[model samples]
Target: MPNAIRRYVRFIDRTNEIVGLIMMYMIFLMIGILLYSSIMKTVAIPPLWTLEMAQFVMVTYYMVGGGWALKNDAHVRMDLIYANWQPRTKALIDTVTVLFLIFYLCLLLYGGFSSTSYALKYGETSYSAWSPYMAPVKIIMCFGIALTLLQAVAQLFKDIAIARGEEIS
Candidate 1:
């Protein structure tokens, strides 16, 4: 790999690691929050803020972690057909899949940006008592999508190289 690509991939890898930890933490936090809410029913009505916050974190983490999943080939898939293909044929199929993802991510980026802009312009807020700044969450999602799209382009190149009988790195 070129130095620049390698550098960026390292950065992406770090981002993925940090975000994965954050996601795991969020899951634990949610569980704790739910238990607390259940226990405190008589004390108070708990809070809806946790729900909205969890939703935002989930979206952000998914987008940011998507590229890392692709790099590790860790995404869940129905791999029965893929497992049967020859190596070279698998590379071809993988290339085709990458192309499809590229197109799909384009749509995602566009939609994400539009939604972010709308949320920012309208000062959108979650239907919770503590209506935090939701625009930051919207923008983070868009940023995450952009990160995945960048990695997709890199993966497309890597796949092309592999298909052409060249090592990816």
Candidate 2:
């Protein structure tokens, strides 16, 4: 691989790793919100925003962490035959299969950006009691999707190198 491509992969991997690590702490935030809600319910009227806010946090967690999951190979797979493959064989298969993932991610990112733009332009809000503005979460979703897409491309490059019997660190 060229130095530029190697740098690109490293940059994407590092960026996603940092973001994913930071986002991992959000689980604690969600837990705190739920705990507050539960305590409030026992003592007084529970805040209407607690549950919805926690949901938003959860969305941020998974969506933003997606790239890191891919980089770390944390995503689930049907390893029936894949698990038995040799390293180069596995890389060859991944080089082909990752194209499908890239295609799907591209479509998802397109829709995510479109929805985010609509939410921003129309000042959309969730149809709930708390009714929070939707743009922030929508934007986050798009950003996350974009990160995942970039990571997918990086993975494709890495797989190509591996398939060609050229290891890329």
Candidate 3:
């Protein structure tokens, strides 16, 4: 990889790591909050933000965590045919699949950018009590899409190297 791309990949790695950490933290926080809310409600405290926070945390956890999932090759995939193929043949299939996903993610990034732009332009905010600006969160979808795209490119290069009988390790 070129220096710039290597740097970008490093950035992606850092971003993926941070996102994973945040997701884990969010999960723990949500679980703790729910427990607290349950206890408080039993005492008539009635935690109001629990429902909204849980919903937002779920979104944050999933969207932010996806790049890390892709980075670690943790996404669920069916490889019945590829499993029987030779390494070189499997590399080819993997390369093609990564390319396809690149196209798909590119579309997502484009649409996300447009939607976020519209939201920001309109000063859109959540209708709920918190009234958090929705644009920032909408933009995160684009960041995730971009990270996935980067990962796809890295995978494409890796697969090509493997198909050429190069030892990737």
Candidate 4:
């Protein structure tokens, strides 16, 4: 593989690893929020934001961790036939299938950006009582989707290299 492609793959892998590790802690934050809400409900009225805030954190957690999941091959797949394939055959197949994933992610990212833009332009907020601004979450969603898309492309390159009997890093 070329130096630039190797560097690009390494960069995307490293970036996703760091972001996913950091976001993993968000599960604890969500837990703490829910725990606080539970305790408050017993002693007094629960804060209006606790449930929704926890939900938001959960969304962020999964959204941002998606790239790492892809990089690690943690996403579920139908492996009945795939698992039996030879390494080069698997790589060849993956190279073709990842294009579909790339295309779908592109559409999702475009929609996310559009929604985020609308939120920013109109100062959109949730309909709930807390009514938090939606832009922040939308922006995060777009960022995560972009990261996942980059990871998909990186995977495609890696697959190509493998199919050609070369290894990337």
Best by lDDT: 4
Tens-place lDDT digits, model 1, residues 133-152: 77898788777777777777
- Per-prediction TM-score: 0.80, 0.98, 0.80, 0.98
- Report lDDT (Cα) of residue 18, candidate 3: 75
**C-alpha RMSD values across all candidates:** 2.7, 0.6, 2.7, 0.6
Q: How high is the CA lDDT of each candidate model?
A: 0.73, 0.95, 0.77, 0.96
Give a tens-digit lDDT track for model 3, residues 1-169. Answer: 4465556566776778777777778788778878888988898866667777777667777777877887777899887776789999988889898888999988888899999999999999888876777887787767767767776776776678789887432
In TM-score terms, candidate 4 sits at: 0.98
Candidate 4: 10-residue stretch with minimal lDDT: 50-59
TM-score quality measure for candidate 1:
0.80
Evaluate model 2: give its TM-score: 0.98
**lDDT value for candidate 2?**
0.95
> Rank order by lDDT, top first?
4, 2, 3, 1
Q: List the residue pairs that clash in candidate 4.
A: none
Residue-level lDDT tens digits of model 2 in 1-169: 9999999999999999999999999999999999999999999999999999999999999999999999999999999999999999999999999999999999999899899889999999999999999999999998899999999999999999998889777
